[model samples]
Target chain A: MSEEKKRKKILEVKDLDITFETTAGNVHAIRGVNIDLYQGETVAIVGESGSGKSVTMRAAMGILAKNAVVNKGEIIYRYCDNIGGIDYNPEYDENAVWKEADILKMDKKWIRKHINGRRIAMVFQDPMTSLDPTMTIGKQIMEGMIWHYKIDKQDAYNRAVGLLKEVGIEDAEKRMKQYPHQLSGGMRQRVVIAIALSCNPDLLICDEPTTALDVNIQAKILELIKKVQKERDIAVIYITHDLGVVAKVADYVNVMYAGKIVEVGNINEIFYDPRHPYTWGLLSAMPDLGTDDERLYTIPGSPPNLLHEKEGDAFAPRNAYALEIDDKLDPPMFEITDTHSAATWLLDPRAPKVEMPKELKLRIERMKKEAQANGSEL
Target chain B: MAANYNAEPLLEVKGLKQYFTVSKTFMVKAVDDVSFKVYPGETYGLVGESGSGKSTIGRSIIRLYDPTAGTITFNGMDISGKMSRQTQKDLRVMMQMVFQDPMASLNPRKKIKDIIGEALDIHNVCKSAAERDEKVEAILTKVGLAKEHADRYPHQFSGGQRQRVGIARALILNPKLIIADECISALDVSIQAQVVNLMKDIQEELGTAYLFIAHDLSMVKYISDRIGVLHLGHLLETGTTDEIFNNPVHPYTKSLLSAIPIPNPELEKNRIALNYDYKTSGIDYTKGTEHLIDGTHYVKCTDEEYAKWTK
Candidate 1:
């Protein structure tokens, strides 16, 4: 479905640039990222660590590290509620007219009051670190509702218990009384999700929420997120490195590499007819359960240094299909279809043809066998 | 059958148990009467969760942690009982270990050459310093690292490169069995493929055995010939990789297999979620140590549902 035709766009991040002032040098962590999230769709921004996916979402929630500075970008939010607590001029509110605020330039106090946890809630990867050891699970869930919504005590308790049940937690009333240590890692994550969903925010950003969880627990957490998104109709931006998780959860995928998104497409487009060489490598590298390849294919070379501020494509050094032009100038994103595009020199019409690795060809063939066995394909 | 009985496995464990006293008196049986065998030129995968004691098994087998009870037999030699300092040093060369955290396992100040050569020096395997250096270079190349990288410190390399150095250090001693305890868990998925492939190639080249311990079921199935599942210090199931994935006898193993997210989007969306009760499924591992007899597999275990799941 087209994002615009939906009721409203909750968040629109345009041309975002993020840099970190480090001891070594100024690291350009995010370079010109643009994203749009409709009311309820789950858009997963996926890549390996240091891919700037987390930085982009952290910018949206106004939660960046001390050294981070946004060089350029506008994070615009259109909300029925004044999440930022700014003086609402009734005349300023119109159809699709987002409150265009330079998130980088916004005051810390204003952003804290309006943006964070009030309208945009986040659930991080590690629950042990994220959760306060001193507090009970019930208090943690109630704390957000009381702070943001200012609801009554008994009502907050009721909502907290209800949320626990909503996320498929058994014995919600009893679970609410327990401390963080009493619960397993999976249950602790569910409690964290309950806290994030308690606010009923416009956007829910999950940064590798299940990376610390086991496979079964990871599946359960992903299912919980999907359920919450469906019921609350909140826009979700799932940040993760696992493509398997992305394929299961994301409706649209943005492949990031070294602070820049090299490809963006529908799930099927990216998986089936990928245009970028990096995307091809990533797809092939995934260990197919059904495949019989003697050796698994690996993408050679490491992620580039973000601190160096490379002039060309950051992935050019590692990309096997890199052209002469790729080494000198950054390739513009080429439009493959109405909904799909990739930033690669090889996609240029003038560039010579280079087929995907032979192992990848075999992987696709094996994937076809799986499709036939499963009786479905994109 | 005679071939299976007569042939000597590269590594064997009989009733291996490691119990830690969590409180003043209450001891937590982290690994209780777990036993398995690793055949030569084969990969045996150990799968478990955080408290499952999979890593404890890996450590105890390589003598990193002293086991409370049970016997560890390496190449028909019982190395379980207390050994002399010299015999222990000699055993270290036969069995090497690769830890999960490459950055922490490797010393940041030391060069790659010194890290690999230290084992050679400790075992007195090398004729001289030059011979040790040459062996380190050869193993570095074998593990896909450049010969020049031997001079660089750990801080200069990436996570994947550091893991390669770790592999090289383990392989330089010409160890018969390498225990990789969650070796690729900390790496990126794309880079993880490279490390796994490197391990497979090295094993094929040297005819070395591997005891691969990981929580990732799919990767275990991909790399291992035989697989063992551990839950709460109990070895619940053991079989071939294909049998474990396709026809899991135990409910826990079945649930674990079903839990792995399929790459296909449609299948993943349509797959039915398995709901196994964690609280009831957990055995009273604290008590019943006397009744728990070690056999080919966990039989008449306290977790009856898990034991009966196969029946």
Candidate 2:
């Protein structure tokens, strides 16, 4: 795992603040967000709707709507010259110094030519909307390569077939002749993934890619993404609300609330030793296969309305372990370890140490025991 | 809860089949020969993925789509299709459906009071305008909404609030059975728990049975008394919640259970997903029969496979 620390940073989002200008008021969607994605690693941003998970990723990809306002932030993307080359050292380059482009600062035309769908690609939540119903699967897949690389139709078709096979589609040749409606939901999502990977991108952003799929299909998609990530050695950012999906795929987890990340840590640290009360609530709310409880441990209230300016910590109202200071002032992120940090009043030196819910503690213990029994790394 | 098990079932669906003809050449058997019973005041969960015919069963039972072949007995009365006007009205009051998309189900032009009170008006349940208003207010509060919400439109509410309005519309007439077709799946995880708890509370207070159809197995295990697993329009397993969770007999049931993503990092890292192949398993569905494993558990398998599974 020491090699993980040596991984180079591919994208860095610093102090991001985004707002949407609505008819009623300006909705502050993202609040001082900070995140870094390392090459060949998977980072998951977990949150409910209106928590700004999608907005952050959309901002990174330069796809924010016209109504959106980037109040203050920089989305710096590092371009590695030796990607898809032999013996690639992501850390440093002696010959061609890596070029860093601020996606927020670049115009739409510049980003389209230099970054979007070539250096960075995105897979949306719904494949029905992302894909064109009129076009055949073969044409749709080949269109990206033909546009970006100026490749011939024959070569693009060959690569498209190879991509379909790589994504585990049976009868790749026959499937290419069909339209989007001819495929199943799972199959459509796989085609979308294939299209995203057609350009050999350096970063892949999946926004709830598997939410529309069944459980069995979801498992297959997650496995396919992991396999492709390793083979391509590209950075991945998964934006989803399902903690279960986060547990299975993410190397690091960021727990978002209202509009800010309340906790950020490695997967094991966030799941086993969570610091924020919001994280605890999220973990307890999910019903596990072994759970026999009468009632789910639901978070007390709904998410805050972003139309108005927030006073303190946005999650303080629903947090059962909230301190008085939480309502008075927002807490800065307190570092627990080099890889773990949380923005909660409970982490303050002056605040009393609060224990997690009994149910979560017991669940964590059982999970640790199961992991040890299976001889698996968490 | 156990005492209610001895009572008559609120809804009984037997040999239900709904088929849609796509073109002149072929037909799609969306639901085929499915059967289940929902006891009074008990939640009977129907679990399956898309194209598994779970949603078709829900729509068929509520008479939105006529069943090709089957008998639907609600309150010990056959109301499958082409019911008389009076019989239709009576059945409509006794059974209500909450759709998956709240935005599409409720009308934009209609106010919340009119939407909730439409059934009352149609059935002539309320004699006066004041009584209708009172009933609407009562149901709005029952679903954790205020009376002022009745004057607003459905677009004014959030997704969770719109779902509450949908529940209020369903509960306004005190239906004996509610067919909730993926009602909470559209909401967030936190709001989903709230809605599930609300459904449980409403069941306790009003004794309303539910045909809860969803793909999430964990939520089904929590709220359901009995569960029916569907795969390719076949009811492969039916058992009590504990029986189904602890001792799933069918290979399809095992695969479905194993496919669920558990929300624990350490446990999920070691989780093994079981894949079931129909062609490789060599279990023919034509000769498949439902065998009783224990008091309340049943598994669909052939004679030889049933013996092997039981052994």
Candidate 3:
């Protein structure tokens, strides 16, 4: 039995619509998307390329490209009463009042002063590209704290060294003096995580943080992020397409497709009992070990091109279980459980039931049996 | 299921050592004293982390970079020494390569047809332009692309489609062995599955042996018949897919396998990666002999190291 923990809404994006002006045409990147991030829980956004996963997070961070236009939507960020949201739990204070702010309406100057680095921090996919080549590792980590809190040079230096040690880097003093190029890929990513945690942000946005690293390093980085989240009780938004990474990091799963949240569910619900056909395709397609099947299942067609004018369901062309109604209208998000929901025509009460791929079903059952044997949660 | 033992090996590397001289006194031993046999129509996966020299082994086999030492034999011919013009020409037809990044590998300036058919022009295999177009279109359709797509440039297609073009480029030569260096690593999971399925379909149709060099363990295990685990430029372990996954011996090999991210949240949460530090393990590759365990499973270790690891 799990304890009833009070979950507070931290970041809310309602009906987000973003378009980019290109030479070919106006690409409607984010089309009427909605995402809800709660306090102290990791939420993962999974999708194929050009599926608007990064664009949604970029919108939340106020880092959208100049050529992009936000046609509609609102992003609400709630500032908790306690610093770092440490005392927002009911045990500390039953009345945890949150002061809400509309992130979209805020000007760049105001946002930079309050929200950008102090309350929220982001780690990019590639650490090499994100870090300044000319700047030393220590300066990059210290700059955020110095700029946000206006701390003294000595204080910032001391904090940077501490953060480096916290991220599991050895010889922090020597590493702080070296540049990004001097460090390995895994070490550089550790430095990036150190910088992100330097400002003590409550919400950490990691967009494929370990995608550019090797597999062994990836496991360590994922562990490090989880360690920090537990220690500080920070809410993490993990943006990645790797299902394994999602299973390792996320508490909630948001499956995005064609700029929309096609499926939102708890990690178990999404992995074990997925309803959407697109979700089924993604789950079945990953090449797993010890499988006898010669052919891996693939989504029948590519994602819909956003440059062209769309019709009913953008996924209708690729869905194997697409109903005639899908051609005429977009499917609404049908609720499966309190924490599980999927956008698909097959979820309609009148529609014929469709089963997930046999291989995926068997795989889930096998995984559940394994977990049960291991005495872990199933 | 694996390389046919009765059949002759398609490619063999004996004591392969590929070292890069950084300075007059310093050298980077990218691939150090590694040897493996890839039989006909089998997929031999070379897996390692960055600087583990999986790609170096592939490059040396393809003659992209001349190996600093060792012998590389292809189809019963020793291709390690200076290649005669006839031998080079023959090798071109028997071997081809697929690079990691489709964007960087393909000629962005040229049309898909030209990019895929460049081998035709180089080898003078096609009689006329119409014939070249026909060959290119056939390969395109084989990889799940249309004839009209041959007219577009690399930028015109999506990441998956561009990768198809890369596969089409390799297929146009009708090569016996294709060294796919992280071919599906850059694509999304769905698209990666599609590309991998395409590769499998092609392999079934042509019976081509693939030297698949990648870091993704799951995918490597899925597609490869036999796997060679590389670490710090040495082949620490080599075995069939089942042997490598079910019963890994070396501590480094075991560590690599443990680091694979499980897709089930329940199981993944219970997982902890086993750590193996070479400096602390007291295992030196420079002083070891490869010992065969059984059924195509081999581990490069000394007598004491083997005894310790097996126990």
Candidate 4:
């Protein structure tokens, strides 16, 4: 914990706002989003579709759609020359210099040259669509390294082979000659990870990377990513709707609702002592194996349409415990602990206290008890 | 769940095999000798990973794919063979299916009313257009959708609403069995609960049985009375939900159950999935005969293997 505090903050997103100007209307996609990532921590941004989880990450990647307009805020990224990887450049800086750049303000050329693949890399959701069908997997993994690092072909080939091995692909030499179509979905995703790792990125942005694979394969992929992240000491920002994925991978959780972050906390706080009603709904909605309840707890309504500006909180209409003030004015982030806060009127000092569902409370207790019985820390 | 055991099954699949001919020289055996039964008012979950042929079995039972071998008996009548006109009409009213992708399965160009009322139109069940609209609206309302939504296209509604439309379409005929193939896989967590609750409510009120096919073990356990674990086109085990979950005999079933990510962070972090590789396991699935664990549980295995697994 002490060393973790000493680690540098690699990325910070402050008051990020984005909008999509469609033919019908202007859709305010992202609204005042804030996130912080240390050198090697995992922060998960979770929400339903159209809640702007992907848009926040896309903005960080500087790969937002052409129609998207970043009206406000900035993504500050800092990387040092000592960012250790196989492709480390010895000629750069003698003592290693820390560099900072606003991704929003940086030039496209500069981003493509330094930030895109060198410092930050992304593994998209669909491996099939992301990988080139025309090229062999080996050449595809080697292309970025050779182009970006100005390395020799033979050196890139050996590095690519080693990467494929690191991602758990066997018979690396034989598999390298295969095309994307010939490989299975799990193998293809592994190859995609290999390509992402080829750049030796300090920050890995995985946008629902394992959603396309099966459950067994998803577990393996998650493990592989965690292993790689630990080894590389890289910060990861995982964007997903699956609570299971988030619970398994995240060090901290960001609960997004209608383009705004409603809750932020560490894994234990978010899972065990969630303050926001949305987080409670999401956690309870997931069907655990040991639950005996006939009916699951569900959020009452859908997310609000982003095109139409609402009066106050976007989730107010759906929250059963919503206060009158929630409709009149948006609630600011209420600090629960040093690392935990919730943006909901329910967390207000003046508002009436409302607990999560009775059944859900029992379930969480059961989970904690079971965890203790299993000799695991909660 | 055992109450339905004494009653005859509504849908019975026996030695079902569905194969696809990739070329003249090679064929893909998607569903090989898979068998199970769905009794009235009880859900039978078919759980399997990708390429496990769970979807293939659903498609074959719905008669979307011609089975390569075996028989499908629906309500004690063989529907696997070439159908007569009356049998064909009976099949339409007796069994319906809700697909995975609501938007793609539903016709985009068609209005919500027409989409739900298509079965009625096919069978000429309604007396007039008003009667059809009334039936559509009633079913739509039953699925928790508004009557006003019937006029809009499938593209107009959100994902959960469209799935409600899909359920409405399948329920318009009031079929005895509804084959929901990964129906809630694409939905958000909160919406998933809503849909699951809605399905459970419909089942309670209408007494309709469901053949729920999905890879999500937690959801399958939640909704299913009985579960059949499929792996690589074979039915590895069949048992009551408790038996399959708590006393899984097959290594494949154990691996699948262990793969499910519990939502609790502490437990999830400590989860070490039991990995099962068929190539290295050295167990021949083809040589296995069905072995009984109990009245409600069965695992396919050779006698020698069965003795080891059961012990």
Best by TM-score: 4
What CA RMSD would you report for each candidate? 4.2, 2.1, 2.3, 1.9
Instruction: Name the runs in model 4 displaced over 4 angstroms.
Output: A1-5, A81-86, A89-94, B1-3
lDDT of 3 by residue, B80-111 (tens): 98999988888889999999899999988999
Q: Candidate 4 docking: what grade?
A: medium
In model 2, the runs with Cα more than 4 Å from the true position are: A1-5, A82-96, A376-378, B1-3
Task: Note the residue pairs that clash in candidate 2.
Answer: none
DockQ values per model? 0.58, 0.74, 0.78, 0.74
Worst 10 residues of 2 chain A by lDDT: A83-92
Off by over 4 Å in 1: A1-7, A82-100, A353-362, A365-378, B1-6, B278-311
Name the 10 consecutive residues with the lowest summed lDDT in model 3 chain B.
B1-10
- Give lDDT tens digits, candidate 2, residues A137-169: 999999988888777899999999999999999
lDDT of 4 at B35: 82
**C-alpha lDDT values of all predictions:** 0.82, 0.89, 0.89, 0.89
Q: Which scores better on TM-score, 2 or 4?
A: 4
- Model 1 agreement with the true structure over A53-163: per-residue lDDT tens digits: 888988887879999988888888776654333223323556433455555667888777667776788999999888998998999999987887677899999989999
Q: What share of the true interface contacts does each candidate keep?
A: 0.61, 0.74, 0.78, 0.72
* Candidate 4 per-residue C-alpha lDDT over A1-102 given as tens digits, one digit per residue, 9 for 90 to 100: 255467679899999999999998999999999999987799999999889999998888888899999999989988775545455643355877777889
Model 2 per-residue lDDT tens digits across residues B186-292: 89889899999999989989989999999998889888999999988989999999999999999989998888898777767546689887788888765788899
Residue B304 error, candidate 2, Å: 2.1
